[model samples]
Target chain A: MSKAWTFGENMNTDEIIPGRYNITIDPLELAKNVFCEVKPEYVKNAQPGDVIVGGQNFGCGSSREHAPIAIKGSLAKCVIAASFARIFFRNAVNIGLPILECPEAAVGISEGDDVEVNLSTGEIINRTNGRRYQANPLPDFVLKIADAGGIVNFLKMHDIQEVLA
Target chain B: MGTLIEEIFSRRAGGTVQAGEIVLLDVDYIMSHDNTTPLAIKAFREIGKPILDKNKIVLHLDHAYPAPNILAAENHRKILDFVKEQQLPHLFQQGVCHQVMLEEGFVTPGSIIIGADSHSNTYGAMGAFGTGLGSTEIGVAWVTGKCWFKVPETIRVELSGHTQPGVYAKDVMIHIAGLLGMDGGTYRSVEFGGEYIDNLPMHERIIFPNMSTEIGAKCGLIAADDVTIAYLENETPAKGPFERIVPANPRYERVLEIDVSLLAPQVACHPDVDNVKPLMAVEGLEVHEVYIGTCTNARYEDLEIVANILKGRKVNPLTRVIVTPASARIYKKALKNGLIEILIDAGCIVTGAGCGACIGRHGGILAPGERALTTMNRNFVGRMGSPLSEIYLASPATAAATALTGRITDPRGCL
Candidate 1:
């Protein structure tokens, strides 16, 4: 079971990880400062496999992949948002951070609510309320990349030329 | 017929690609700056591959250049080593990546360029299909010389009427951002058109695309026309057989018509780029600092506007003013034109050319409870310094006027 940490719409990358700390790219190091400005206690209280639930355009602003990297490093299982900015979605995929688009789950989930998710089946269960929601399942190619622990590992197994062709 | 993005992607994909289809396309240029290049280098090493084509990769040591801290210095050293090891020929240490990219002639119409920074959309001003990506994707592009893209649905914004004096492109863009909330253009392409855009010079046209990201746009574009061709032929080093690509019969998901005939000078308030209000609403608000620089407005013409306002006036004693030109070339041009002298004479601290203070890595940073008025884009929390500090976004004219008054003053009154 994972606890949901809810946030409002248009939660930007600068809120996730401030630009001042972008000099270091280490995921763990970046994790320490995740939500440091917006939610000062997030890094301290967040547990492994916790979930982040947000309204529209989550992870908006800037192309800093550090935002997703920090969230992944924080041991958050996945981020469920009503929508995501274009660059953030791609960055999450590149880093193997699971994300789902489910307006129902994003709006229904409450802070500290225990939840369960199934990436392959797109099933999201709110254990606290006994509600089940369906998220838009990721594409097959994206699922393949996530399964291999991101594109780098996927590329290690497949030929780049073949993939491009 | 397809939209502008569809046309660009179809040509790159060598097929009839639609908005929703994901396709792998060859990228012409891949750019990374100091803030991201270090991370991309690490990812590239993890891939254990040689750079597929070193010439296609561009590196800039602009963000936090000269190293604000030990970690940043170390990151710069790592990037320098990687550039040398790869024998990369396009490494630049002098200017913001976006400005240098255009000045060096890497941006051409109908070309696809991806950078590891959000404002890569600035290249779209010249009619290129440019967008930002993460470091890992940039690293992968370095290895394969290609990247996948989900062709975005286009939003057509048509601007009409004449822009009044003191109403610049920055004001027009801020007004647009207010009309459309932060997510108005999420994951979509925004194409600016109509008489207003048609009349803007290349420098002014660049702001729309550069600020499109503020509204969550994947890219902001304007079709290449004679003005674009003229700029490329005369201004840039591009010896391009440039292609003028306009949609023959374009389809748009939504169309918005905006009239800027009497648009007022606008400001995007603290903690949100979309919380825009006219200068009358926020006028006389005291500011601790005023910054005039960024990819959005630090071009030569923008400096001239500020210099005209500050030519014989002194900056208010209570406020600190910092001016950073977008590029070294722009800095030289401003110096040659005596704009730097006017700015310096008015008591503004002229800093080196780069993404100075805009990213809060170096240069002027606001303290807690302080407020700043800047010409840069993005006023998200903690963007320019303390999270408790406030940032107001406006044009260089507004910045100059506010700097002179130590408060948010209307540029028209000063003019």
Candidate 2:
């Protein structure tokens, strides 16, 4: 169970991690500024096991990986949204940030609610509200990549690079 | 049975691929710039492996060039050292990554390409499956020479009819953005077809695909034909062999038909790319700056139009006009054709052939409360400097005309 931070739709990349802080590639440094422009209290108030609930089209702009890295670096467990921009979905997978698409969770989960997401079974349980929702299940390959803590780790353990190359 | 994008994926996967199916395809080229290279390097090191093939990778030092400060300078140094240590041969210190990739002939037809920058879709002008990926995925591609992709549903767009004088490809693209909405093409592939596409030159073909990212498209494709072959012959010393693929009884998720003749010089207003209107709708708005350059509209054909408009007339006394070519090659061609001289004689400030002023990192940062009409894509707030500053996206011809009046003006009469 993790607390929830609710946000509106069309939250662009610039609002997630502003371009001004893009000078450094460090994830921890980027973590200090997540949602700096839109939600000033986010960096300070967010906890390690918290969850983010957003409406449609979350992370819509830019192909920057900094957005997901910042969220992961902050130790957030996962992000549950109604829908995600295509690039944001791929970027999250590359960086090993779990994301679940559950429209019910997006609408039903309130701020400070204890939300738990089960990626394999596509289940979302809101302990605070005593409600449950079904999330879209991820494909086997996508789950494999995320469970391995990103593609880099998967490649390292399986020697898939040479096999694929 | 399949669309152009589906067929391309099927050929690469060695079997039939449908929309929503995931497939791993070999990448022909991987491109990155100064801003993204540092992160990719970090990821590549975390993987603890060598790049699959150094020859297929290209690096450019265009963004924040000459170092806005010590931080940027140090990052450039780190990238240079990594390139030297890895013995990578292709590095361009003078051009934007997209332009450099095309000039070096890394983006031929019927190949899969990826870059760290979003404008990588520009390569799809040659019928290639080119798109942008994040730095981490780029790092994965660097090490494995492969990336997984979901076969995106295809939206077939049939372009027809001709534009009046002064109405350029930029106007058509902006109009389409208005029709499709900013996120209409999200998670989809867009392909151009019909007779109007046949009449467009390579310079114009680049814009449709280059601006496809504005609509969140995975890739934008135009099938190869004789025009593509002729363009290759003129641009590169050698051409890669390519056989055009046409799907038999093709199926598209949806089809959109556009007539350029119906378009007036279009402009995307402040804060959004899809907040579009006719040029005349916002004609009287005063402008403080006029910028002409970017991967979208900095081609020789675009500059030729600008030079013709500003050949003898000077820019408005209140407005500042800045011109930057997209690449060193285009700059040299413009110089040889006396376009640069005409621009300078008309009081335009000519800059280097890099992405100057486009990214707001260097060269021209708009002051607070300033308004600019530019030929670049993306006019989001705080995109070019202070959030108070505003940007209007338009064609080079419209930009040039606006420069002469210090206001958003149509290019028809000025030309």
Candidate 3:
């Protein structure tokens, strides 16, 4: 249960992880720079478990996974937007970031509001407003990937080790 | 109990995918622009592995031609350094990756391709599941042949009727995006078809897939056809496997139609490709910049449209316009056609043929609180340089018109 960190709708990847750092490869390095290019001071003042709620077309622009990795690396638990870009959404999941599509939820969740997300039930509860949004639940297979810390690691974790006799 | 959609799902689907689900993916293509190469080169060494496939890799220089910024010039040097060292197959000394890939041949339909730059989905026009990626994921994908993907559901867009005098494919896309809202198509595929789409010029139909990502679709496409064959043979030649793949009319779960005959002038409001309205509705909004570049609409024909508009008149002093061709070849052709001179004589700045404003790598960025009407794609916040800047998406005609008036003006009146 954490207070939600809110932003206006349509918060893009460039706003979430600006282009000045598109060159960097380290996820941790990206985390430090997340929103810094756009907001300049987002990471310095941001707390862990904050949620970025946005409006339509959130995470639009280069299908870069860094957009999500940077946000997740910064320790933000989830990003709830009215909608998510296809590539951005895919990249976020591929990197083990949480993105919730709560079209109506953003209308109610203001900045500095508190919200808790239940991974199992796909529920996001707003503490200040006593509001609840039922987010679209994730696919079972994708959950395994995220649970195992993204796809690359998830593949490593689920190694069945073929025993050829 | 399941149908074709569920079948495409079963092939890659596992676990639960829902609105709140943030799942990991396997990458197919990893692409990079001029700036990211130096760092990507450094990280590749840290990964400590030989490139898995050089042929699959693409290294392009789309930003800063004649060199825009010092950093871009330095980046160009780094890209040349690494591309030569690795013996990469897909290196573009002149064109943007989007045009070069479709021309020189790197994107294979059905393969998932990622780039270090945004708008890599330009390849989706050729039917590849291409998109942008970060330097890290790109570096890793270079080492390992495997990438991740979670099957995304598809949204079908059907187009009907024929084009009116001035409407083009870009307008059609912008018009739809405006209606659907930016996020409406988020996380879906736009499968295009209908009477008009079926007969569109292969090069023209490309505008659909190229700008699909702007409206949030992963890849916008019309199933490959005879027209595609004609274009591929003309653009990319060699004995390769390419078959005409058409989507079954009834198999498409959702269908949308656009009667080109009935459409009018359109514009994507500042900062959002989907914030669209009739161009007439937003008329009179002043513009200080008009950019006629980027992978989405910087095609050769796109240049011709601009040249035609500015042939006889000078641009408005208050408005600064830049036109970057998609490739060196297009540059030469425009020069041959005398379109380049028309642009320059009219005070339109012409840069090298790489992606300029479209990639935000260089050229045509707005100052804080500045406004622009452009023919490029993706007008998100801080996209062009200043976070407070505003951008409106439109056709080359509209862009040229605005360039003449120094604000959002209808192209129909100027000519």
Best by TM-score: 1
Answer with 1 or 3, whichever has the higher lDDT. 1
- Give each model's whole-structure lDDT: 0.91, 0.86, 0.71
Query: DockQ: which candidate is best?
Result: 1
Poorly placed runs, candidate 2 (over 4 Å):
A1-3, A109-121, A125-130, A161-165
Model 1, A104-136: lDDT tens digits are 999999999999998778899999999999999
Task: Please give the range of 10 consecutive residues that has the lowest summed lDDT in model 2 chain A.
Answer: A156-165
lDDT of 1 by residue, B276-333 (tens): 9999999999999999998998999999999999999999998999999999999999
Count of backbone collisions within predicted model 2: 0
TM-score of each: 0.98, 0.95, 0.84
Residue pairs clashing in model 2 are none
DockQ-based class of model 1: medium
Q: How close to the true structure is residue B21 of candidate 2, measured as C-alpha lDDT?
A: 86
lDDT of 2 by residue, B68-164 (tens): 8888899899999999999999889877788778777777777899988888888888888889888988888888888888999988889999888
lDDT of 3 by residue, A75-158 (tens): 888888877766676567666787787788877888778888876677989888888889877666657656766545643435
TM for chain B in all models? 0.99, 0.98, 0.88
